[model samples]
Target: MTPLLVAVDVGTTSARAGVLTRDGAVLARAEAPIEIRREGAERAEHKSENIWASVCRAVAEAIAKAGADTETIVGIAFDATCSLVVRAKDGAPLAVGSDGDPDWDTIVWLDHRALAEAEEARATGHRVLDFAGGALSPEMEIPKLMWLKRNLPKTWQRAGYMFDLADFLSWKACGSLERSQSTLTSKWSFLAHEAEGWPADFLTAMGLEDLRERASLPRHASPIGHPLGTLTAKAARELGLPKTVIVGTGMVDAHAGALGVLGAFANQPETIDRHLGLIAGTSSAVTALATEPRPAPGVWGPYFGAVLPGIWLSEGGQSASGAALDHIIRVHSSGAAPTPLMHAEIINRITQLRSQCDDLAPRLHVLPDFHGNRSPFANPKALGVISGMSLDASFDGLCKLYWRGAVAIALGVRQILETLNARGYAIDTLHVTGGHTRNPLLMELYADATGCTVHELPDADAMLLGTAMAAATGAGLYPSLADAATAMRHASVTREPDRSRRALYDRDYAVFLKMHAHRAEIEAML
Candidate 1:
């Protein structure tokens, strides 16, 4: 049996697997829905067992679909959201929320239960904050860890492992406790540019001085493409794959998608800095790499080795984009969220309505900070606002709102680009992947709204192929990730910005900034 590479991506809603040839051709892909428990506005959680089981099922299904024998799966790598996973010293899942359900061991990346803690951490004014866009968000690990220590003392005291979701998968696959450099540098506030990596003084200031020791973290992070070890026998048996499979250090899922999208430009520095990779889904991440560090205010990073070795990466995004669009549809007078059929109908409805007016949703505007502003304003307290809502509650009204919502999401992307550009990046092109690519309106708005040339990934599942590239690199099929990615990248379809729509979006962008300023005014008055 010839060896194959496997990529596993654990997203907010599902666990997906791709079995691919070494050259990056996807042979088979499968997905399994995982469980999430939302306990009000502040908390969201997932069962570790459910995630792991879903991942195993997905991998097995993919291998079966590919008709690849278990022994032929020679290399495996994982990428997942930056959720926090906690386990007891004996390896049992521990509760992360107030429900006290031990199975709910993962704090989802979008959870905002740590807002106060995040603000407190930001107040520390530590040097580490400089790397994290001069301020940190509730979404980061430190704030979440601080929240656990304060509110769930018993769980925190009993926990021995705190793995970022990606590292959790790698550990589950190979029994290696090493963390990924990408994960540590990007989310855990490890100062990758510094020789020491972990900022001990910063952690001490946050009262989590014992985190590294308690979590059993390695003194140094393993680079993204570094091989961890052969798959453990238990893991192999569970996955129904061969023990000979090599495992690689993993990264934040969006970063992996960025790697897949932008890796071809690795050697071309001038081209790389001008191209941003947008991986949008339940949320969105805009990633750009620079050979020289260029720290932008409110954008996370200038993070060294977060995306590629020796390249500094900066990330900016909306805390909610696709998710916000979904929420708009659900809460509209139209009632509950549309089923896939209904959503498609809504897209059709929007398209038809646009035919009626050259200026669809022209007066309507939305600030998509429903989940808090993750970047370009590092503020977690930001709330979403919708201007110019009419009293009409008909399906037509819903369509108008939906159209504006899509435009707003793209406008959010535009705002982020401005921040990046101001800080030294001249991004005139955006490579977009993920679920957002499925929405025709968003695809158009991204280019028209941002006035940037857009490239749609030819692969429907680029994240999976990206993790496959990592597996190939770790397996020594490619000398480095750059080599593997360049070899594996697919052709992209280009979309030039619509000059005709530019003026309309310019007015919308003005309203977008005004909304922020208006928000501040109201807050001060309150």
Candidate 2:
């Protein structure tokens, strides 16, 4: 029988599953939406029950679609958003809300209710903060945990398990409380390269001394792609897989996407550092691989062994790329709500608009930090800036706005690449995956604005494919993740930068930087 692996990607809005053979062929894929509840502008929550249910449904459907025998499914792997999942001692979901809604048991990655807590965490000036992008953001686990400890003491007292969503899924599947190095080092401030991994004194300084034991987190994190254990009978039945299936350690979804896109170059070892992974979805995560730790100011990482062992990863991205675009369309005078059809219509119109005009929104400029800057600046309070807008509320105006917004998002990438190149990375090639691939305009600007060769691989689900590679290794199909990555790397359709437009983008990038400086000046005055 042909060995197969199931890779599940639990994203912000959906749980997507793909079944693949050991040789990188995606047999079938399926997705199911996971509901998010937002009561306040800063509050976003998900029910772990709902997320796991979505995962199971998506996996079952994908397996059925593949028409593969369940016995042949030898391993499974998971990658999920860095959401914080709270559970009671007995394993029931613990409400993270004041209303005590069990359905709101998880705090989402983008939730900013912990903004004050993040600031407080940063104020501690602990050594752990150094690993956390030189400052902490509300998105990381520690701040969210601090928020729970301070605001919901009762919930905090009752909560026995605090799982990064990925670890939660892995534990649910294989009955292992082992966290992944990718999850721990990248988001939870567990330094994988360090001997003690856990910063006991740091947590104690924040009065979160019990967090380590509360999470039931092991002393050491499992390496990415390592098999933790076999799936429990209950999980096996729920996922429609065989009991023989081993479950591999999981990672953050974007990290997994990084693995998917950049892992292909792992065999090269020499030039992989020249490649960056731009995984865009509701939010964007810009992942850069490094053989050694080269920590730069304001970027989220230089995390050791976060994606691949013996390699460090630095992450920089816009907090609001897709969401910014969605907001642009929703609030525009000429636009209705943003639907798939409307988005496609805008994309189609922009194609024609660019044909007529050399630059669609040459005068229009956008600062796409609406949800705040997640990279090279690490300021969560950052706001979006629009330089050109008028009473022109025509549909054409909206398309132009969308076009400029897309370019600005790409320019944001340019700004990060500047910082990356300044630090040490010779990032000439960007391997892009996820939602940005679906937008032709964004894909084009990714190359033109950033002046990097864009590699868009087969449009297959790279996150799932990356997870599958891990699963394949865990199932004994390969000796290590490096070998699996080498075998499973999918070829890409390459797009080179339009060098002729370098002058245009250089000017735009200048304006982008000036705008950021201006915003900072105004904030300083206030």
Candidate 3:
């Protein structure tokens, strides 16, 4: 029988799984939705059990679809959002929020309930902050833990183990508490480069002195692709796989996508800095890898071995990209729901409008920070700004706003790219994957607005492909993660920037920056 691998990716709303061969060709793929309970604008929660169940379903369905026997699968790996999952000593769920329901045990990564805590962490100005873009983000684990401890004291007291969602999934699979270096270094403020990964002083300063003990975190983080042991009998039964299948250390979903696209250059580290990975979905993350640490303000990382071993990764992101576009459609009078068909209709209309007039909405401008700025500003408090709007509530008017909104999203990426370039990276190529790839308008803008060549991977899901590479390494199919990546890498369809539209976007970018200044000025007046 041919050896196969299962790669699971749990995102904000869904769990996806794929079955791939040793050479990285995906045989089958499946997805299952995981519920998110939203309490308010800033708070979101997930039941860890539900997420695991979703993963199991996805994996089982994927295996069945591929018509592969359970005995053929030799490896499994996971990638998830950096959500925090809490559990009691007896392995029961522990609530993470004000709600007393233990079932709501996971804090979603996009939860901003810890904004104050993040600001408090940023105020410390500790050396640890240097690795995290000189500011802490509420989206990271530390601040969220602080929020849990402060707001849910009873839950905090009951907490016995805490895990990054990816690590949590691994534990579920193999009953191991080992955490991934990718999750620790990138989100939990663990210094992968230091002798002591966890900074005690920083934890003490944040009143989380007992965090390591409370969370059951280990002194050392396992590198991505390290074998954590085979799945437990129970896990094997649940996932419809054999217990002999190895479970590999996982990573943040964006990092997994990074590996999928950029892993091809694992052996050619010298030119890796010229390429970047843009995992654009509900949000947008720009990942750049380099031989040495390249830290920049508002850009998270310089994380050692977060993705590839011995490589330093720098991540800059927009907190809302596709989400912002969805919000625009929802709020517009002519729009109903932001469904795929609706988005297609809007894009189709916008294209028609653009052909009629090169400048579709010349006056309309948007600063796409509706969910706060994550890159180049690091301001979670930052609010989106929009200028030039008329009382036109027609469908055409909605299309105009939507088109401009997409442009703003791309412009935000351009700003992040400029920041990365200034901070020792020579990135001129963007390897894009995820939901945004399906959006023609955003795909075009990603190249044209950023003046960078955008390479979209073929039909294979990059996130799953990246995790499959890790699984292939752990399964002993490859000597190293780099070898797995080099063997499994896929070719991409490239889009070059349209230079003729450069002057127009240049003007828009100027307006985008000016809008930022103006928003700041207006906020300062308050």
Candidate 4:
């Protein structure tokens, strides 16, 4: 019997598990939604127990669906959001709430309630802050921790372990406390580009020196491929699998998407130098492979061994993409609660209506940075701006504004690519994967806006496939991540930029830039 590998991807909204063959074919898959609750601007949280339950359910469902011999499963790999997870010494949930129920322990990555703390840390001029786009936003771990320390002092004092969601999942399954280089270097300011461990002074400066003594953390590549002992008997039974299955170290969810696609393309003869991976989901990230580490001032990383091992990665992205679009529709409404079904239909109807216009309209321009800018200029205080809006309250008009926002996001991506290209990083084609890729208008807009062809994987589950590939490696089926990607990844369609829309986008991009600059001015004034 052919051996199978398991890949579990824990995302912001869902947990997915897939059973796959050595050659990259997915035999069965399962998905479970991860609950999210947002309190206010930049405040998002998830229950750790809920997340773990989702993982177990997804894995069990996938195994049952595959109908394969359970003993054939050789290895498992995991991936999840870079969100922060806090637990007490005995592994009990430690609430991070200011005054709500004392059960919320997970701080969703989108949570920016730590903005004040992050800004204060930035003002300290810590050298470690340079790796994170020259400024640390509340999105990273330390600031969030600091917020907990100041706002939830009692909880902070009692907390025994803190983890990036990806690492937390790994620990839960195999009892390994090793951290991924992808997770620490990208979000926790761990030095991957350098040969040393975490900078002592940097931690002290950020008022997080206490973590320097933590015993559970492991370096990026040190504990990389070791089986974190087999899945615990408890985790195994919960997942409906044998306890002896090997569990390998995992990666950040987007890096898993990159590992699933870009890792493979980097080795290909045709797409090596300039290929970029756009993982568009709740947020958007632009990932590119680099030969050596090169830092972009306001963008994240030059993270070594973060995505594909040994190759450097420079990541640029919008802090909000799909979420921003959702916010756009919600707030633009005068006095209406847009149901999920209604909201989606509104977007579709708007998209179809926009298709009827002459492909050029001056009545819409939207700045979708409602969650603050995450790339090119690491300003977390940046606000969204809308221009060219008429008094028209029609849904079609709303859709046009929505499309303009999407187009503006693409333009922002182009700006990052331009920055990278200007600084000597070559970007040739874009390989995109994620939930937003399902939108034809979004893909076309991105291609036209960036003047590059957009290639999406045929599988539609690149993140899961990426994790599965890692399992394939741990099972000794593939030599490396690059090898796994090539065998498993398949391009379904390529969307090329249209010349007619190119000129219109060019003019519109200028206005987009202007609107952002004006917003900055207004924000500073306030």
Candidate 5:
């Protein structure tokens, strides 16, 4: 019987599962939306039970569609948003909100409810803060835990375990509490690069020493193919699979994308050390693998054994790329109303508007930090700045603003790459995948701005492919991630920078830097 691998990817908006053959071809795929609830300022929550249900549904649908025998599916893996999942003993939900509802057990990654707490934590001048790009944002796990202690003290006291969303799913499926170094070290401030376990002082500072007391921290929390027990009979029934399926340690969604593609360069004689994986999504992340650890300030990294078994992974990105564009388009125009035309129609209208533009936001450049700056300058408090806007509020003008905003974001990616290049990393090529990768104009702009050859995976769903790669490793079809990526990953299209527009962008990017610097000066004066 031909072996199959099943991968469950739980993202910010939905849960998805894909079944892939040994060669990395997707045989079946399924998705189910996960609900989000917001109660104003920085509060975003998802029900843990609902997320699990969606995962089960997506997995069942994909397996049924593939028509593969349950016994033929050799392994399972997962990837999810770096959201924080808190639960009480016996796996009961513990509210992570101010309203004190036990059902709200999750603090969605996008939630900024812990902003003040994050600021406070950063103000302490903790040495570990340097690892998180000099300033830690509330989007990370530690700040959320601190916020829980400070604001939701009762729930904090009741909490039995804290899990990054991916680890939580792994725990749910195989009943192993081992957290992946990818999520814990990258987002939770766990010290994975060093021989030391999680920093005791850091945990003490966050008042999460109880976690250490329970000895939940793993000695070697790096990503490994753990025979993490079996799919619980209960979960197996829900997913319509056999209870004996093996599960493995999983990674964050974007990290999985990195794993899926980074290995594609195997045996090509190109040094994989300098290759950077640009995984763009609602947000953008830069994942790079290196032989020795190199810590780039304002970039989160030197994560040990996060992706490849022995290589260090450095990750950095804008908190809002796709999200930023959506925000700019909505706020600059007539609210979030869907255009009378379809999405393609609206995109065409925008394209036409851009053709009529004389200059790229001659008087207008947006900072694109509406959410928070996640790279190079990890300042969450940095408010967005839109320089040089007139009183003209026409919809067409608004569309132009949107175009400028997308370009500005592309420039931010450039700024990040510039930082990396200066730190002795050679980023020669860009590999992109996600919902945003479908936007050809945006892809071209990214290539032009960064001056790198941007390649898109042939498979529309690379994250699914990535998770399946992990499962394939567990199924013993491939000896390593590199081997699987070579057979499974291929680039269907490539976008090169347009030299004709290089001079224009070169000037515009300088202005982009000036606007941000000038805004900082302007704000300081106030």
Candidate 6:
């Protein structure tokens, strides 16, 4: 029987699973929604059990759809958002939010409740920040932990184990306490290239001196594709797979997507910096890998071995992309739920309008920092700005705003690209995969606005494919992660930038930068 691998990806609102052959062709896929409990604007929580249950549902459904015998499923792996999962020593969930519900034990990655804590961490001036874009983000694990310790003292006292969401999933799979190098290095400030991954003095400075022991973190992190062990009987039964299935180390979701798209260039280390991976969905993450550490302020990384071993990875992104579009629709007078049909209609109208005119909303400008700016500026408190609005409350008005929003999103990617290039990367190609691929307007803008070749893998879900590559290595189907990647990677359809649109986008980009300065000036006065 041919060996198959199961890959699970847990995002903010759902868990997706895919069953793939050893060669990287996905045989089946499934999805299940997970709940997010939001308290006001700055806090979000997830139930660990609910997330695991969703994962189990998606995995079982995918295997059933694939019609593969349980015996043929030899490996499983996971990738998830960099949310923090807290638990008791006995492995039961512990509440992390104010609701006091034990089920809501995980902090969502976008939660900014730790903004103050993140600032405190930045104030320490520790060497750990050297790898972290010269500052700390509330989205990272340390600040979130600090927030929990300072605000929920009772929960902190009861905490015995903490894991990055991906590590938590791996532990649930095979009952292993091991953590992935990707998760630790990218989200938890673990310096993979150093003798000591975790700096004791730095944690001490941040008032997290006992964090390692409290979280049960291992001194050494397991590299990506390293097999933790076979699935536990309980996990195997729940997932409808055999206990012999190997459980591979997990990764952050964006990192997994990076591996999926950039894995083909793994052997071409000298020119890897010429390519970037844009895993854009609810948010947009631009991932670039280089042969050496190339640190840039406000760009997260130079994370060693976060994706490929011995390669440094840097990430910069907009905290809101698709989500910003959804918000624009939701707030508009002629809009509803921002469903697929609705978005398609808007895009169709915009396309028609652009055919007749040079631009749909030429005067309208948008700064899509509604959720906050994650890159270039690294300002989490930043607010979105929309210029040139009128009393137009018709459907066309909504379409105009939506079109400008998409343009802003693409412009943000261009800014991030410029920053990366300035810091030593020569990225000229963008390998894009995610929900944004479905939007025709965004797809066209990605290439034209950014002036880079955008390669879209239409046949593959890069996140799932990347996780499957890790599973293949863990199952011994390949000798190394790079080998698995090279074998299973998909061909791409390239979209070259339209040179005619260069002058238009250049003018808009100039306005985009000016809007940033104006927003800063207005905020300073307040």
After TM-score superposition, the amount by which residue 165's alpha carbon in candidate 3 deviates from its true location, in angstroms, is 0.9
Backbone atom clashes (below 3 Å) for every candidate: 0, 0, 0, 1, 0, 0
The reply for model 4, stretches above 4 Å from the true place, is: 35-39, 99-103, 150-157, 219-226, 268-273, 327-357
- Candidate 6 deviation (Cα RMSD): 1.5
**Which scores higher on TM-score, 4 or 5?**
5
| Overall lDDT per candidate, in order of appearance | 0.87, 0.88, 0.92, 0.78, 0.77, 0.92
Of the candidates numbered 3 and 6, which has the greater TM-score value? Answer: 6
- Which digits, one per residue and each the tens of the lDDT, describe model 6 over residues 347-460? 898888888997678899999999778899988879999999999999999999999999999999999999999988998999988899898889999999999999998777
Worst 10 residues of 3 by lDDT: 454-463
Tens digits of per-residue lDDT for model 1, 71-112: 777789999999999999999999888878898999999898
Kindly report which residue stretches of model 3 are placed more than 4 angstroms away from their true locations once superposed. none
What's model 5's TM-score? 0.91
RMSD in order of candidates: 2.1, 1.7, 1.6, 3.0, 2.7, 1.5
Highest-TM-score candidate: 6
- lDDT (10s digit) by residue, model 4, range 297-412: 67787777787767777888888988777777787753145455655776677667666775644757878888778778887767778877788777666677777777887888
What are the clashing pairs of model 2?
Answer: none
Candidate 5 — what's its lDDT? 0.77
lDDT, model 5, position 457: 69
> Which stretches of model 5 miss by more than 4 angstroms?
222-224, 266-270, 332-343, 346-364, 391-396
Instruction: Give residue 395's lDDT in candidate 5 (0 to 100).
Output: 67
lDDT, candidate 6, at 61: 93
Provide TM-scores for the models: 0.94, 0.96, 0.96, 0.90, 0.91, 0.97
Candidate 3, TM-score vs. the true structure?
A: 0.96
lDDT of 4: 0.78
